[model samples]
Target: MLEIVPIRSDSRARARVKVRPPAFLGEPEPDTSVGQEISKAGVGIILCAGALIGLGGFLFFIGGLLTSGGITGFVKGWLTAFTGI
Candidate 1:
Protein backbone atom coordinates (compact mmCIF):
# COMPACT_ATOMS: atom_id res chain seq x y z
CA MET A 1 0.00 0.00 0.00
CA LEU A 2 1.29 3.48 -0.99
CA GLU A 3 0.63 6.38 1.41
CA ILE A 4 0.56 10.06 0.19
CA VAL A 5 1.97 12.69 2.58
CA PRO A 6 0.46 16.22 2.80
CA ILE A 7 2.66 19.12 1.57
CA ARG A 8 3.59 21.91 4.03
CA SER A 9 1.73 25.19 3.46
CA ASP A 10 4.21 27.58 5.16
CA SER A 11 7.17 28.62 2.92
CA ARG A 12 9.30 29.56 6.01
CA ALA A 13 9.09 25.97 7.22
CA ARG A 14 11.05 24.81 4.11
CA ALA A 15 13.73 27.51 4.43
CA ARG A 16 17.28 26.47 5.51
CA VAL A 17 18.44 27.64 8.97
CA LYS A 18 22.17 26.67 8.75
CA VAL A 19 24.68 28.98 7.00
CA ARG A 20 27.80 27.83 5.11
CA PRO A 21 31.15 29.63 5.14
CA PRO A 22 32.39 31.24 1.94
CA ALA A 23 35.13 29.52 -0.10
CA PHE A 24 37.01 32.81 -0.32
CA LEU A 25 36.77 35.05 2.78
CA GLY A 26 36.74 38.49 1.14
CA GLU A 27 37.68 40.65 -1.90
CA PRO A 28 41.38 40.81 -2.74
CA GLU A 29 43.10 44.12 -2.09
CA PRO A 30 44.85 45.90 -4.96
CA ASP A 31 48.59 46.57 -4.97
CA THR A 32 49.10 50.01 -3.34
CA SER A 33 52.50 50.79 -4.94
CA VAL A 34 51.77 52.47 -8.26
CA GLY A 35 55.42 52.96 -9.17
CA GLN A 36 56.25 49.30 -8.77
CA GLU A 37 53.29 48.20 -10.91
CA ILE A 38 54.17 50.75 -13.60
CA SER A 39 57.81 49.66 -13.64
CA LYS A 40 56.86 46.00 -13.95
CA ALA A 41 54.41 46.74 -16.77
CA GLY A 42 57.05 48.83 -18.57
CA VAL A 43 59.64 46.06 -18.36
CA GLY A 44 57.13 43.56 -19.79
CA ILE A 45 56.28 45.90 -22.67
CA ILE A 46 59.95 46.56 -23.45
CA LEU A 47 60.78 42.86 -23.53
CA CYS A 48 57.80 42.13 -25.83
CA ALA A 49 58.74 45.02 -28.14
CA GLY A 50 62.37 43.86 -28.32
CA ALA A 51 61.31 40.30 -29.14
CA LEU A 52 58.99 41.54 -31.90
CA ILE A 53 61.75 43.74 -33.37
CA GLY A 54 64.23 40.84 -33.34
CA LEU A 55 61.75 38.51 -35.04
CA GLY A 56 61.02 41.10 -37.73
CA GLY A 57 64.73 41.62 -38.28
CA PHE A 58 65.33 37.89 -38.64
CA LEU A 59 62.42 37.47 -41.08
CA PHE A 60 63.65 40.47 -43.08
CA PHE A 61 67.08 38.88 -43.41
CA ILE A 62 65.69 35.50 -44.46
CA GLY A 63 63.17 36.82 -47.04
CA GLY A 64 65.30 39.70 -48.34
CA LEU A 65 66.81 37.54 -51.09
CA LEU A 66 63.41 37.10 -52.81
CA THR A 67 62.25 40.75 -52.63
CA SER A 68 63.63 44.15 -53.73
CA GLY A 69 62.19 46.07 -50.75
CA GLY A 70 63.82 44.48 -47.72
CA ILE A 71 67.27 45.31 -46.26
CA THR A 72 69.05 43.36 -49.03
CA GLY A 73 66.65 44.90 -51.55
CA PHE A 74 67.67 48.46 -50.66
CA VAL A 75 71.36 47.58 -50.77
CA LYS A 76 71.06 45.78 -54.10
CA GLY A 77 69.01 48.61 -55.56
CA TRP A 78 71.55 51.18 -54.43
CA LEU A 79 74.56 49.25 -55.75
CA THR A 80 72.92 48.50 -59.11
CA ALA A 81 71.48 51.97 -59.66
CA PHE A 82 74.12 54.23 -58.10
CA THR A 83 77.42 52.36 -58.57
CA GLY A 84 76.45 50.65 -61.84
CA ILE A 85 78.14 47.39 -60.72
Candidate 2:
Protein backbone atom coordinates (compact mmCIF):
# COMPACT_ATOMS: atom_id res chain seq x y z
CA MET A 1 0.00 0.00 0.00
CA LEU A 2 1.28 3.50 -0.91
CA GLU A 3 0.49 6.62 1.07
CA ILE A 4 0.02 9.92 -0.79
CA VAL A 5 1.16 13.21 0.73
CA PRO A 6 -0.25 16.59 -0.36
CA ILE A 7 1.69 19.87 -0.42
CA ARG A 8 0.46 22.95 1.45
CA SER A 9 -1.67 25.06 -0.90
CA ASP A 10 -0.12 28.45 -0.04
CA SER A 11 3.41 27.07 -0.29
CA ARG A 12 2.69 25.56 -3.67
CA ALA A 13 1.45 28.89 -5.00
CA ARG A 14 4.51 30.69 -3.62
CA ALA A 15 6.82 28.23 -5.32
CA ARG A 16 5.24 28.97 -8.67
CA VAL A 17 5.84 32.70 -8.13
CA LYS A 18 9.61 32.25 -8.02
CA VAL A 19 11.40 33.17 -11.28
CA ARG A 20 12.53 30.18 -13.35
CA PRO A 21 12.58 28.75 -16.87
CA PRO A 22 9.46 28.12 -19.02
CA ALA A 23 8.56 31.76 -18.41
CA PHE A 24 5.27 31.52 -20.31
CA LEU A 25 3.55 29.56 -17.57
CA GLY A 26 5.27 30.56 -14.31
CA GLU A 27 5.32 34.37 -14.60
CA PRO A 28 2.46 36.48 -13.22
CA GLU A 29 0.11 38.39 -15.54
CA PRO A 30 1.77 41.78 -15.03
CA ASP A 31 5.39 40.70 -14.48
CA THR A 32 7.99 41.28 -17.23
CA SER A 33 10.66 38.66 -17.90
CA VAL A 34 14.28 39.70 -18.48
CA GLY A 35 14.92 37.34 -21.41
CA GLN A 36 11.61 38.07 -23.10
CA GLU A 37 12.04 41.84 -22.67
CA ILE A 38 15.52 41.72 -24.25
CA SER A 39 14.23 39.61 -27.17
CA LYS A 40 11.39 42.06 -27.85
CA ALA A 41 13.80 45.03 -27.70
CA GLY A 42 16.21 43.33 -30.09
CA VAL A 43 13.43 42.67 -32.61
CA GLY A 44 12.29 46.29 -32.41
CA ILE A 45 15.82 47.54 -33.06
CA ILE A 46 16.30 45.28 -36.10
CA LEU A 47 12.95 46.33 -37.61
CA CYS A 48 13.68 50.03 -37.12
CA ALA A 49 17.18 49.70 -38.64
CA GLY A 50 15.78 47.86 -41.69
CA ALA A 51 13.11 50.51 -42.22
CA LEU A 52 15.63 53.38 -41.98
CA ILE A 53 18.11 51.68 -44.35
CA GLY A 54 15.43 50.92 -46.95
CA LEU A 55 14.00 54.46 -46.87
CA GLY A 56 17.45 56.07 -46.96
CA GLY A 57 18.55 53.98 -49.97
CA PHE A 58 15.37 54.86 -51.89
CA LEU A 59 15.77 58.58 -51.21
CA PHE A 60 19.47 58.56 -52.20
CA PHE A 61 18.71 56.79 -55.51
CA ILE A 62 15.97 59.29 -56.36
CA GLY A 63 18.18 62.25 -55.46
CA GLY A 64 21.04 60.99 -57.64
CA LEU A 65 18.78 60.37 -60.66
CA LEU A 66 17.07 63.79 -60.34
CA THR A 67 20.36 65.71 -59.98
CA SER A 68 21.99 63.86 -62.90
CA GLY A 69 19.22 64.32 -65.53
CA GLY A 70 15.93 65.24 -63.81
CA ILE A 71 12.67 63.29 -64.62
CA THR A 72 14.13 61.90 -67.84
CA GLY A 73 16.82 60.10 -65.88
CA PHE A 74 14.24 58.57 -63.57
CA VAL A 75 12.23 57.19 -66.51
CA LYS A 76 15.36 55.88 -68.17
CA GLY A 77 16.44 54.09 -65.03
CA TRP A 78 13.03 52.41 -64.65
CA LEU A 79 13.00 51.22 -68.27
CA THR A 80 16.49 49.82 -68.02
CA ALA A 81 15.56 47.87 -64.85
CA PHE A 82 12.37 46.46 -66.40
CA THR A 83 13.98 45.47 -69.71
CA GLY A 84 17.28 44.29 -68.08
CA ILE A 85 19.09 46.38 -70.69
Candidate 3:
Protein backbone atom coordinates (compact mmCIF):
# COMPACT_ATOMS: atom_id res chain seq x y z
CA MET A 1 0.00 0.00 0.00
CA LEU A 2 1.30 3.48 -1.00
CA GLU A 3 0.43 6.68 0.97
CA ILE A 4 -0.10 9.93 -1.01
CA VAL A 5 1.14 13.22 0.59
CA PRO A 6 -1.43 16.02 0.71
CA ILE A 7 -0.42 19.58 -0.32
CA ARG A 8 -1.30 22.32 2.19
CA SER A 9 -3.66 25.13 1.08
CA ASP A 10 -1.53 27.78 2.89
CA SER A 11 1.40 26.99 0.52
CA ARG A 12 -0.18 29.31 -2.13
CA ALA A 13 0.17 32.26 0.23
CA ARG A 14 3.93 31.71 0.48
CA ALA A 15 4.53 32.29 -3.28
CA ARG A 16 7.01 35.21 -3.69
CA VAL A 17 7.05 37.82 -6.48
CA LYS A 18 10.21 37.60 -8.60
CA VAL A 19 11.67 40.90 -9.96
CA ARG A 20 13.43 40.51 -13.32
CA PRO A 21 16.45 42.69 -14.09
CA PRO A 22 16.07 45.08 -17.06
CA ALA A 23 17.14 43.44 -20.32
CA PHE A 24 19.50 46.30 -21.37
CA LEU A 25 20.71 47.14 -17.82
CA GLY A 26 24.27 45.90 -18.36
CA GLU A 27 24.62 46.28 -22.15
CA PRO A 28 26.57 49.04 -23.92
CA GLU A 29 24.63 51.59 -25.98
CA PRO A 30 24.63 50.99 -29.74
CA ASP A 31 27.39 53.02 -31.43
CA THR A 32 27.40 53.94 -35.10
CA SER A 33 31.10 53.72 -35.96
CA VAL A 34 32.77 56.19 -38.35
CA GLY A 35 33.34 53.43 -40.90
CA GLN A 36 29.64 52.45 -40.83
CA GLU A 37 28.55 56.07 -41.27
CA ILE A 38 30.95 56.54 -44.19
CA SER A 39 29.73 53.35 -45.85
CA LYS A 40 26.11 54.48 -45.50
CA ALA A 41 26.95 57.87 -47.02
CA GLY A 42 28.84 56.17 -49.86
CA VAL A 43 25.78 54.05 -50.67
CA GLY A 44 23.53 57.10 -50.67
CA ILE A 45 25.94 58.98 -52.91
CA ILE A 46 26.15 56.12 -55.40
CA LEU A 47 22.35 55.81 -55.53
CA CYS A 48 21.92 59.56 -56.01
CA ALA A 49 24.57 59.57 -58.74
CA GLY A 50 22.82 56.77 -60.59
CA ALA A 51 19.48 58.58 -60.23
CA LEU A 52 20.96 61.80 -61.60
CA ILE A 53 22.47 59.99 -64.57
CA GLY A 54 19.17 58.26 -65.32
CA LEU A 55 17.26 61.53 -65.04
CA GLY A 56 19.67 63.31 -67.39
CA GLY A 57 19.37 60.51 -69.91
CA PHE A 58 15.58 60.56 -69.71
CA LEU A 59 15.41 64.33 -70.16
CA PHE A 60 17.76 64.28 -73.12
CA PHE A 61 15.86 61.51 -74.88
CA ILE A 62 12.43 62.87 -74.04
CA GLY A 63 13.30 66.21 -75.65
CA GLY A 64 14.93 64.48 -78.64
CA LEU A 65 18.14 66.20 -77.67
CA LEU A 66 20.42 63.14 -77.76
CA THR A 67 20.60 59.44 -78.71
CA SER A 68 21.27 56.42 -76.45
CA GLY A 69 22.57 52.89 -77.13
CA GLY A 70 19.78 50.58 -75.98
CA ILE A 71 16.01 49.90 -75.99
CA THR A 72 15.29 53.37 -74.66
CA GLY A 73 17.11 54.84 -77.67
CA PHE A 74 15.04 52.69 -80.06
CA VAL A 75 11.82 53.74 -78.34
CA LYS A 76 12.82 57.40 -78.47
CA GLY A 77 13.66 57.09 -82.19
CA TRP A 78 10.27 55.50 -82.89
CA LEU A 79 8.47 58.15 -80.89
CA THR A 80 10.30 60.93 -82.69
CA ALA A 81 9.51 59.40 -86.06
CA PHE A 82 5.80 58.99 -85.28
CA THR A 83 5.50 62.38 -83.64
CA GLY A 84 7.36 64.09 -86.52
CA ILE A 85 9.46 66.34 -84.30
Candidate 4:
Protein backbone atom coordinates (compact mmCIF):
# COMPACT_ATOMS: atom_id res chain seq x y z
CA MET A 1 0.00 0.00 0.00
CA LEU A 2 1.22 3.51 -0.83
CA GLU A 3 1.62 5.82 2.18
CA ILE A 4 0.55 9.48 1.88
CA VAL A 5 3.07 11.86 3.52
CA PRO A 6 3.35 15.64 3.67
CA ILE A 7 5.60 17.21 0.97
CA ARG A 8 8.83 18.79 2.26
CA SER A 9 10.65 21.71 0.63
CA ASP A 10 14.08 20.59 1.97
CA SER A 11 15.98 17.62 0.64
CA ARG A 12 16.76 16.48 4.21
CA ALA A 13 15.16 13.32 5.61
CA ARG A 14 13.10 15.42 8.08
CA ALA A 15 9.63 16.52 6.94
CA ARG A 16 8.46 20.11 7.25
CA VAL A 17 5.35 20.49 9.51
CA LYS A 18 2.76 23.10 8.58
CA VAL A 19 1.32 25.09 11.49
CA ARG A 20 -2.44 25.41 11.80
CA PRO A 21 -4.74 27.68 13.78
CA PRO A 22 -6.53 26.44 16.89
CA ALA A 23 -9.57 24.26 16.31
CA PHE A 24 -11.82 26.69 18.19
CA LEU A 25 -10.47 30.23 17.75
CA GLY A 26 -13.47 32.00 19.29
CA GLU A 27 -16.51 31.45 21.53
CA PRO A 28 -19.06 28.87 20.44
CA GLU A 29 -22.36 29.96 18.92
CA PRO A 30 -25.33 30.36 21.24
CA ASP A 31 -28.07 27.75 21.37
CA THR A 32 -30.97 28.11 19.00
CA SER A 33 -34.73 28.38 19.70
CA VAL A 34 -34.94 24.61 20.18
CA GLY A 35 -33.00 25.00 23.41
CA GLN A 36 -35.73 27.27 24.76
CA GLU A 37 -38.38 24.74 23.84
CA ILE A 38 -36.44 21.99 25.62
CA SER A 39 -36.16 24.19 28.70
CA LYS A 40 -39.90 24.83 28.70
CA ALA A 41 -40.67 21.12 28.32
CA GLY A 42 -38.36 20.29 31.21
CA VAL A 43 -40.09 22.80 33.47
CA GLY A 44 -43.48 21.49 32.39
CA ILE A 45 -42.48 17.92 33.26
CA ILE A 46 -41.23 18.95 36.71
CA LEU A 47 -44.41 20.87 37.46
CA CYS A 48 -46.59 18.00 36.29
CA ALA A 49 -44.70 15.50 38.42
CA GLY A 50 -44.93 17.78 41.46
CA ALA A 51 -48.66 18.27 41.01
CA LEU A 52 -49.19 14.50 40.70
CA ILE A 53 -47.16 13.86 43.84
CA GLY A 54 -49.11 16.50 45.80
CA LEU A 55 -52.42 15.08 44.64
CA GLY A 56 -51.29 11.57 45.57
CA GLY A 57 -50.28 12.74 49.06
CA PHE A 58 -53.61 14.45 49.54
CA LEU A 59 -55.45 11.30 48.56
CA PHE A 60 -53.28 9.21 50.89
CA PHE A 61 -54.01 11.59 53.77
CA ILE A 62 -57.71 11.41 53.09
CA GLY A 63 -57.55 7.62 52.95
CA GLY A 64 -55.74 7.53 56.26
CA LEU A 65 -58.36 9.75 57.87
CA LEU A 66 -61.15 7.48 56.66
CA THR A 67 -59.50 4.14 57.47
CA SER A 68 -57.92 4.75 60.86
CA GLY A 69 -59.57 3.31 63.97
CA GLY A 70 -62.02 5.50 65.89
CA ILE A 71 -63.03 7.77 63.04
CA THR A 72 -63.91 11.26 64.22
CA GLY A 73 -66.78 13.42 63.06
CA PHE A 74 -64.21 15.75 61.38
CA VAL A 75 -62.74 12.84 59.41
CA LYS A 76 -66.20 11.67 58.37
CA GLY A 77 -67.06 15.18 57.25
CA TRP A 78 -63.89 15.41 55.21
CA LEU A 79 -64.52 12.01 53.60
CA THR A 80 -68.08 12.97 52.74
CA ALA A 81 -66.91 16.27 51.27
CA PHE A 82 -64.30 14.60 49.14
CA THR A 83 -66.22 11.43 48.11
CA GLY A 84 -69.86 12.47 48.53
CA ILE A 85 -70.35 9.27 50.61
Candidate 5:
Protein backbone atom coordinates (compact mmCIF):
# COMPACT_ATOMS: atom_id res chain seq x y z
CA MET A 1 0.00 0.00 0.00
CA LEU A 2 1.17 3.55 -0.93
CA GLU A 3 0.16 6.80 0.86
CA ILE A 4 -0.20 10.15 -1.04
CA VAL A 5 1.05 13.37 0.64
CA PRO A 6 -0.83 16.61 -0.05
CA ILE A 7 1.04 19.90 -0.55
CA ARG A 8 -0.36 23.07 1.06
CA SER A 9 -1.08 26.07 -1.24
CA ASP A 10 0.49 29.23 0.19
CA SER A 11 -1.01 32.57 -0.86
CA ARG A 12 2.40 34.13 -1.57
CA ALA A 13 4.70 33.16 -4.44
CA ARG A 14 8.08 31.67 -3.43
CA ALA A 15 11.18 33.81 -3.97
CA ARG A 16 13.30 32.25 -6.74
CA VAL A 17 16.88 33.46 -6.38
CA LYS A 18 19.94 31.55 -7.62
CA VAL A 19 22.65 32.18 -5.01
CA ARG A 20 24.96 29.27 -5.83
CA PRO A 21 25.68 26.67 -8.48
CA PRO A 22 24.51 23.10 -8.02
CA ALA A 23 26.96 20.73 -6.27
CA PHE A 24 27.54 18.76 -9.48
CA LEU A 25 28.95 21.86 -11.22
CA GLY A 26 32.75 21.97 -11.07
CA GLU A 27 34.54 25.00 -9.55
CA PRO A 28 36.51 27.22 -11.97
CA GLU A 29 40.31 27.22 -11.78
CA PRO A 30 41.82 30.58 -10.73
CA ASP A 31 44.42 31.85 -13.23
CA THR A 32 45.18 35.57 -12.86
CA SER A 33 47.96 35.57 -15.52
CA VAL A 34 45.57 34.39 -18.28
CA GLY A 35 43.18 37.32 -17.66
CA GLN A 36 46.05 39.79 -17.46
CA GLU A 37 47.56 38.55 -20.72
CA ILE A 38 44.20 38.78 -22.49
CA SER A 39 43.67 42.35 -21.26
CA LYS A 40 47.18 43.38 -22.37
CA ALA A 41 46.67 41.88 -25.82
CA GLY A 42 43.28 43.61 -26.15
CA VAL A 43 44.81 46.98 -25.23
CA GLY A 44 47.67 46.47 -27.68
CA ILE A 45 45.26 45.62 -30.49
CA ILE A 46 43.08 48.69 -29.70
CA LEU A 47 46.06 51.04 -29.66
CA CYS A 48 47.40 49.68 -32.96
CA ALA A 49 43.98 50.07 -34.58
CA GLY A 50 43.63 53.62 -33.28
CA ALA A 51 47.10 54.55 -34.57
CA LEU A 52 46.33 53.08 -37.99
CA ILE A 53 43.04 55.01 -38.19
CA GLY A 54 44.79 58.27 -37.25
CA LEU A 55 47.53 57.69 -39.81
CA GLY A 56 44.96 56.91 -42.50
CA GLY A 57 42.99 60.07 -41.67
CA PHE A 58 46.15 62.17 -41.84
CA LEU A 59 47.06 60.72 -45.24
CA PHE A 60 43.52 61.33 -46.54
CA PHE A 61 43.57 64.97 -45.43
CA ILE A 62 46.99 65.56 -47.02
CA GLY A 63 45.86 63.89 -50.24
CA GLY A 64 42.76 66.10 -50.34
CA LEU A 65 44.85 69.25 -49.78
CA LEU A 66 47.31 68.26 -52.53
CA THR A 67 44.55 67.33 -54.97
CA SER A 68 42.82 70.72 -54.86
CA GLY A 69 44.74 73.11 -52.52
CA GLY A 70 42.25 73.93 -49.84
CA ILE A 71 38.53 74.79 -49.49
CA THR A 72 38.72 77.71 -51.95
CA GLY A 73 40.74 75.69 -54.47
CA PHE A 74 38.29 72.79 -54.19
CA VAL A 75 35.36 75.15 -54.88
CA LYS A 76 37.15 76.78 -57.84
CA GLY A 77 38.12 73.43 -59.30
CA TRP A 78 34.56 72.18 -58.88
CA LEU A 79 33.15 75.30 -60.61
CA THR A 80 35.69 75.16 -63.43
CA ALA A 81 35.13 71.45 -64.03
CA PHE A 82 31.34 71.82 -64.16
CA THR A 83 31.03 75.26 -65.79
CA GLY A 84 34.03 74.76 -68.18
CA ILE A 85 35.17 78.31 -67.24
Candidate 6:
Protein backbone atom coordinates (compact mmCIF):
# COMPACT_ATOMS: atom_id res chain seq x y z
CA MET A 1 0.00 0.00 0.00
CA LEU A 2 1.32 3.41 -0.97
CA GLU A 3 0.76 5.98 1.78
CA ILE A 4 1.09 9.62 0.78
CA VAL A 5 2.61 11.81 3.49
CA PRO A 6 3.77 15.40 3.50
CA ILE A 7 7.56 15.64 3.31
CA ARG A 8 8.96 17.75 6.08
CA SER A 9 11.63 20.31 5.24
CA ASP A 10 13.30 19.93 8.66
CA SER A 11 15.45 16.81 8.91
CA ARG A 12 15.44 16.84 12.75
CA ALA A 13 13.92 13.78 14.44
CA ARG A 14 11.33 16.08 15.96
CA ALA A 15 10.36 18.26 13.01
CA ARG A 16 8.31 21.44 13.32
CA VAL A 17 4.70 20.70 12.48
CA LYS A 18 2.97 22.82 9.89
CA VAL A 19 -0.32 24.24 11.13
CA ARG A 20 -3.30 24.30 8.82
CA PRO A 21 -5.94 26.95 8.76
CA PRO A 22 -8.94 26.26 11.03
CA ALA A 23 -11.92 24.41 9.58
CA PHE A 24 -13.93 27.62 9.56
CA LEU A 25 -11.24 29.02 7.27
CA GLY A 26 -10.75 25.81 5.36
CA GLU A 27 -11.93 25.77 1.72
CA PRO A 28 -13.51 28.58 -0.24
CA GLU A 29 -17.24 28.70 0.31
CA PRO A 30 -19.26 26.58 -2.15
CA ASP A 31 -21.22 28.31 -4.90
CA THR A 32 -24.00 30.27 -3.21
CA SER A 33 -26.20 30.28 -6.34
CA VAL A 34 -27.16 26.66 -5.76
CA GLY A 35 -28.41 27.44 -2.24
CA GLN A 36 -30.19 30.55 -3.46
CA GLU A 37 -31.97 28.62 -6.17
CA ILE A 38 -33.09 25.99 -3.65
CA SER A 39 -34.41 28.67 -1.32
CA LYS A 40 -36.29 30.32 -4.18
CA ALA A 41 -37.84 26.99 -5.13
CA GLY A 42 -38.77 26.34 -1.50
CA VAL A 43 -40.50 29.69 -1.24
CA GLY A 44 -42.43 28.95 -4.42
CA ILE A 45 -43.51 25.57 -3.00
CA ILE A 46 -44.64 27.16 0.26
CA LEU A 47 -46.64 29.80 -1.58
CA CYS A 48 -48.19 27.16 -3.82
CA ALA A 49 -49.19 25.05 -0.78
CA GLY A 50 -50.69 28.09 0.89
CA ALA A 51 -52.70 28.95 -2.22
CA LEU A 52 -53.97 25.37 -2.51
CA ILE A 53 -55.01 25.34 1.15
CA GLY A 54 -56.86 28.62 0.72
CA LEU A 55 -58.60 27.34 -2.41
CA GLY A 56 -59.62 24.15 -0.61
CA GLY A 57 -61.02 26.11 2.33
CA PHE A 58 -62.92 28.39 -0.03
CA LEU A 59 -64.37 25.38 -1.88
CA PHE A 60 -65.39 23.79 1.45
CA PHE A 61 -67.15 26.98 2.52
CA ILE A 62 -68.96 27.24 -0.81
CA GLY A 63 -69.96 23.58 -0.60
CA GLY A 64 -71.40 24.09 2.87
CA LEU A 65 -73.32 27.17 1.69
CA LEU A 66 -74.87 25.17 -1.18
CA THR A 67 -75.95 22.04 0.75
CA SER A 68 -79.63 21.03 0.88
CA GLY A 69 -80.30 22.39 4.38
CA GLY A 70 -80.94 25.93 3.03
CA ILE A 71 -79.96 25.82 -0.64
CA THR A 72 -83.43 26.90 -1.89
CA GLY A 73 -83.49 29.95 0.36
CA PHE A 74 -79.91 30.81 -0.53
CA VAL A 75 -80.77 30.72 -4.27
CA LYS A 76 -83.83 32.92 -3.70
CA GLY A 77 -81.66 35.44 -1.87
CA TRP A 78 -79.21 35.60 -4.80
CA LEU A 79 -82.08 35.91 -7.28
CA THR A 80 -83.54 38.81 -5.29
CA ALA A 81 -80.15 40.48 -5.01
CA PHE A 82 -79.51 40.26 -8.77
CA THR A 83 -83.04 41.27 -9.95
CA GLY A 84 -83.63 43.83 -7.22
CA ILE A 85 -86.83 41.92 -6.32
Q: Rank the candidates by TM-score, best first.
A: 2, 5, 4, 6, 3, 1
Residue-level error in angstroms, candidate 6, position 47: 0.5
Collision pairs in model 2 = none
Residues 1-85 of candidate 1: C-alpha lDDT, one tens digit per residue:
9999988777464566876454454332353367776787899999999999999998876676557667667688868989888
Candidate 3 backbone collisions, by pair:
none
Candidate 2 similarity to native, TM-score? 0.47
Q: What's the TM-score of each model vs. the native? A: 0.41, 0.47, 0.41, 0.44, 0.46, 0.43
Residue-level lDDT of model 5, residues 1-85, one tens digit each, is 9999787686677798966644443333343467776787899999999999999999987787689979788778778989999
Q: Please provide, for model 4 over 45-70, each residue's C-alpha lDDT reduced to its tens digit, 9 standing for 90 to 100.
A: 99999999999999987777667644
Candidate 6 lDDT over 1-85, as tens digits, reads: 9999998888668568887654464243444466776787899999999999999999976876677357787677678889998
Which candidate leads the pack in lDDT? 2
Assess candidate 6 and give its lDDT. Answer: 0.76
lDDT of 1: 0.74
Q: Which residue pairs in candidate 6 collide?
A: none
Q: Note each model's CA RMSD in angstroms.
A: 14.0, 9.7, 11.9, 10.9, 11.8, 11.7
Superposition error at 82 for model 4 (Å): 27
User: Residue 26 in model 1: shift from native, Å?
Assistant: 18
Worst 10 residues of 5 by lDDT: 23-32
Model 4 ranges off by over 4 Å:
1-32, 69-85
The most accurate candidate by TM-score is 2
Model 5 TM-score, all chains together: 0.46
Q: Which segments of model 3 are wrong by more than 4 Å?
A: 1-29, 65-85
lDDT of 1 at 20: 47
Two-way lDDT contest, 1 vs 5, winner: 5
- Candidate 3 backbone clash number: 0
| Candidate 4 local lDDT, residue 43 | 100
Candidate 5 lDDT at 61 equals 70
lDDT of each residue in 18-66, candidate 2, tens digit only: 6655537644455667888789889999999999999999999888787
lDDT of each: 0.74, 0.80, 0.76, 0.75, 0.78, 0.76
